[model samples]
Target: MTILNETATRTDRWTPVCSYTDLLPERGAAVLVGTMQVAVFRTFDGALYALGNFDPFSGAYVLSRGIVGTRGGEPTVASPMHKQVFSLVTGVCVDDPAVAVPTYPIRVTDGTVEVSVV
Candidate 1:
């Protein structure tokens, strides 16, 4: 595993989560990294995104079960519990900007999906 710190120097350290073939386009998958549950997504355009799986409104680990779509050109996922849409790139809740989830850096190397959690 590789660790990366968010600071003046933006360095990316990736940890393999799953195979790229395991993910479906425009869908989200729940993955466990350490004690955190991460929601990994593969967009229709072949873009990959990762965010915390916990939903702030419902306090449930169900972000991965949310619906994937775009709102005003920004890619987003709607929480399954309360339908709170969240930005996939920034993790900010669309309905309530103050509430947001943690977003992780993700990449696909070769045929595997990797996310930077540190």
Candidate 2:
């Protein structure tokens, strides 16, 4: 897992979290953006997503350890603690629409994965 440090370049509001190659397909990694704990995911098709690491259902900062998969074509991550699935695109709970986690805007510049925590 890569952490944001002095070496990472900041482009406007986006902060560099890790290199695109550092993330494995269908896996997640946790990184600290200021005081926020962000969970970064790379889908099997090479898509990238960023969500808040806190699991609302379990009250634990463990979303980074969730199982990555899909639901009706939507990329998702199932909370490891309670098995609550969340949409990687919108961060909405798949089982409970009213419940949701925060999603961050992410993009890759060159080969680095950057997320906007602003």
RMSD of each: 3.8, 5.7
Cα-based lDDT for every prediction: 0.86, 0.88
Off by over 4 Å in 1: 1-12
TM-score per candidate:
0.89, 0.89
Worst 10 residues of 1 by lDDT: 2-11
> Candidate 2, clashing residue pairs?
none
Clashes of 2: 0
lDDT score for candidate 1 against the true structure: 0.86
lDDT of 1 by residue, 1-118 (tens): 2222222221256678999889999899999876779999988877888899999999999999999999999899999999999999889999999999999877767787877777
lDDT of 2 at 110: 83
